[model samples]
Target chain A: MLKAIWDNIKGLYSLLVGLSITGRYLVSPRKTIHYPRQVVDDEILASFRGPLELTRGRKEPGQTRCISCQMCVRACPGHCLTVIKGDAKAPSRWIYDFSLCCLCGACVEACPAGALAFSHKVYLVATSREELKLDLLADLKARTEKEAPPKNE
Target chain B: MDLSLAIFVQIIVAVLLIIGLMVGNAVVMVYMERKVAGFIQRRPGPYEVGPWGTLQAVCDSMKLLAKQVFLPGNVDFILYYLAPILAFLPVLLLFLPVPFGPILTPLHINEGIVLILAFAGLGVLSNLLAGWSSNNKYSLLGAGRAVAQTVAYEIPMILALLAVVLQSGSMDLAKIVGQQGQYPWQWNIALQPLAFFIYLVSLVGETNRAPFDLPEAESELTAGFHTEYSGMGFALFFLSEYANMLLVSFVCASFFLGGYKGPFLDGIWWTFIKAYLIMFFIVWIRWTFPRVRFDQLLNINWKWLLPLGLLNLWLTAVLVKFLV
Candidate 1:
């Protein structure tokens, strides 16, 4: 009975010790990100796997190196892509649905023309089902015109 | 009629005070838990918002309120809807009998200790209802664990309380506190140290805190009984959890720490400070310890706490007769 009482006192002492240790940190700096209000830094963003984007080359102009070999279509596991061959008058358009794209970068790897590449831009993904579809030809034209590297000797 | 009106007004004020304390403690505890966890992990928790993340809880409550409620088709509509309220109501009711301080005493019931225990037990029933009503197997398992664990721990807890009653010769918390004021060394903790230790362990288990948190084991049970609940329903469960933590800590203070007794102040402020100090300890233990396995949790209660508590009771009885 005496031993049991002693053990109980020991337990209380240990609990008090634990409490003191934690009480010290009650006023310490907290390591929580107030997300949505403050965006994560680029280094942190690079570590996290977010949405993927298509890339453009510095030297190539008015040209996407895509050979239309259908390798990306074959490689796609989600089967979210549709490719229609371009006639002589119409520019080739690849309709890529962001809804179906897993952001796996398989299409970027399979493109032999170097026309397809992943971009660093993230956070454009839409929540609505209809907004996820991307018009590849329109996107490509815009990319070539807007994001093309600056011309210099 | 005039006397009845006075009683009515008193009741309203009491209820409001309990609600205000619950809300304030829940908000403070949420921030404190995060900050403690971050510091323990050697990182800064939330500094960017309103002077060292004090507004984090307010923002979180807003976010939870803004979230859309999602109800699945297969759920039992009424029970599914009622579960969060069931989980919340008992904790609020439990607070009615808790005396914050001698002067700040809100409601004084004759059997206040029993009232506290009764309402505390109701929390387990809420967990059971939440789990079984969700129509999910994991919920069922979680609820089963909750019932079993409550049964095991409550025995030791009650036994510990019985020791306190023996020492103070009263179950009325106000009287118990009054008794402690007679002497400097007469605090129940000093006389009934074993009971205090048992009560502390049982308090942790009773609150379903870490090392005893099988009811809502996220890794295995996926939010446990409240898995299917969302929006306001989820928020209510969250509120009740912190309320229950506050309730246990308050009880601990009342029984052992000389409820509301301070070196100089000797009033409600002392009670509030001691209660929050106990709450800080509870939160600290929660973040520091990894959860115990379901079987081990029950084993600690049944094979250890129950027997030790019984032995403590017998010892207390003999000591009170001879020593006191």
Candidate 2:
């Protein structure tokens, strides 16, 4: 009986120890970055894989490196890609259904022209299913224009 | 009992003020508990609602007020409706006798401690009523647990307080506070450390705060007794809960920690400081500890706290008889 009482006393002491540990953490700096007010580190954002976009051509930033190979369309497990071959080797339409994307990086690997890469669009929000059907050619053009030098001032 | 016009007016005003105090205490405690929990978990809790989430509790109370009062089918309507009111109103009565300051007590009853202790038990009746009348199996189970736990824990709490009453030689709360010295070492806690520890344990158990929150055990019982309540019905329970915590913390301050009497000052602020410190400790432990099993909770009360409290009471009685 005496030993049991002593054991409980020791158990109560351990409870105090637990309180002290949490007390330290209560005053410690918060780990969260307020999302709207601040974003995470550049390194983490760079490493993040969001939706896929067509890689820019080495010579002309506006031109697509895709050669209508259909390797990416074939490799995509979700069947989210639509590439209609045009007059030349370049594709006329590059439709990417983002809703069906599993973000598995299979399409990025199978591209022979190295024309597909993951974009860092962490705050991507789609209100409806129809809005998720992204026209990658138009997206690439918008991005190219945004990155281009200002027209001769 | 001379019923003077002035005394009657004071009573009415005090009741209204106590209601305001209970609501204000609920708001402050909600902010403190959430902020403390957030800090412990390394996150900024409730930041978007107002400046540093100060008005978060206000917004939440507004939401609860605006919510639909849902009545589940087959409930005993009268008792189901009565439970939340029963839980809340008795607590205001409990606050009356608490020596908030030397001069600040709402009522000056000679048997103040008795009044507080007696009415404190009424909270459990509401829990039982809410549980039984709700017609939900989880609510019934929760109410059953609440009844048993409250009944079991009250013994040790009474014994602990009785030990202090023995030492102070008064059942009157203000008189008890007057007996203690202002400093920490001069408090009743220094004289009867065992009783203080017992009271602290039972205070948590009595308040039904975690890890003693088995009645509202979210994992097992799904909000327990208040499972069927919504809108203002739920809000009343929440208000009474924080009010009850504030009440017991005041009792602890008065009994053990030298209520309204502290180092450097002898004012109402001392009582507020001591009571809020106890509330902070309660919030601290709620985040720190896991809920004990029902059997374990009972065993702690019956085997450990009850026995210790009785021993402490016996020792106090012996010392008071011969030494004092």
Candidate 3:
């Protein structure tokens, strides 16, 4: 009975300890980043894989490194990719149905020419499935054009 | 035998003001609870609604007001409608006896503590009615738990306050306040610390706050008795719960913490400050502790608090008889 009493007293003391621990945390600084007002650090966002994009060729910024091998099309589990081979090794059309893409990185790994990679488009949003069907070659061209003037300077 | 026109007007005005206090207290408490919970969990809660989310509770109340009053099928319609109203109305009467300041009591009566304690039991009736009338098994279980918890805790609570009543030699709340000194050391808490401790524990149990919130244990009961209530029905329960917390805190402030008496000034502001500080402590602990098991909750009351409260009351009586 005395032991029980002592144990209960210790348990009551433990309650106070719990309160003190939480009380210390209560005045401590909050860890939330407040998303809209501030974005995440680039270091944290660096490894984020959002959607597939065509990497720029080493020789020319606007040119694709893809050689229309159809390897990525075969590698894609979701059958989300379509490549129409042009007269040259370069592809005329590279369509990526993002709605269908599982983001498995299989297509990126399968590319022999090192043409495809994941873009850090964390803010990507779409209202409909059609909006998600991306034209990768056109996206590459727009990106190259946006980068051209800055490089010339 | 005769009630004056001025007295009648004062009572009417006081009732109206008390209603406003209940609604306002509910709004403030919602924001406070969420923010404190957020801070403890290392997040910023409710920052988007207004400046530092000050108006989040207002928006939430508005949403509750606009929501469709969806009643479940085959409910006891009169009792179902009556439960929330019953839960809310008794709380207004409970505030009437609280000595907010030296001269700020709404209705000064002789058996003030008795009035408050008796009416407080009416809240449990509302819970029972809400559960039984709802035709839901979870609601019935919640109501059962509420009845048991409230009934068991009330004994220790009454014993705790009874010790203070003996110490002060009065049941009049203002008289109790008048007896205590205007400082921390001179408060009843210093003299009757065990009773104060018992009162604190029972206060949490009686209010159905966390650690003893078995009635509304979310994971187990899915909001307990008020599960079927939506829109204004749910809102009324929410308001009453906070108002109940405020009432008990006020009781604690007066009986143990020297009511409207503080070091600097003796006024209603002291009462408000003390009461809110107690309320803040309630919110703090709600975030800190997990809910106790239903059996453990009862065990704390019956085995520990009840005996401790009796011992304190007996000691206070013995000391008062011979020493004081």
The most accurate candidate by DockQ is 2
Candidate 2 has an lDDT of 0.94
**Model 1, CA-based lDDT:** 0.78
The clash tally of candidate 2 reads: 0
TM-score of 1: 0.71
DockQ of each: 0.22, 0.78, 0.74
**Candidate 1 chain B: 10-residue stretch with minimal lDDT:** B178-187
Error of 1 at B208 (Å): 0.9
Q: What are the C-alpha RMSDs, in order, of all predicted structures?
A: 6.9, 3.3, 2.8
DockQ of 3: 0.74
Give interface RMSD for all predictions: 3.4, 0.5, 0.6
Writing each residue's lDDT as its tens digit, candidate 2 over A1-153 gives: 999989998999999999999999999999999888899988889988999998888777788999999999999999999999999999999999999999999999999989999999898899999999999999999988997862321
Count of clashes in candidate 3: 0
Better of 1 and 2 by DockQ: 2
Please give the CA lDDT of all the candidate structures.
0.78, 0.94, 0.94
Model 2 agreement with the true structure over B1-324: per-residue lDDT tens digits: 467877888788889999999999999999999999999898988898879999999999999999999999999999999999999999988988888877898988899999998999999999999999999999999999999999999999999999999988899999999999989999998998999899999999999999999999999999999999999999999999999999999999999999999999898999999999999999999999999999999999999998889899999999999999
Candidate ordering by DockQ (highest first): 2, 3, 1
Candidate 1 per-residue lDDT over residues B1-324, each given as its tens digit: 998898788878887878887888889988988877788765677666799889999999899999999987678878887878888877767877777767666777778899989878888888888888888888888889889888789999999999888877788888888777633476788878878888988888988888688988999998887888888988988889899988888888888888888686678787778888888777788876678898878777787778888998898888889988
lDDT, candidate 3, B115-135, per-residue tens: 999999999999999999999
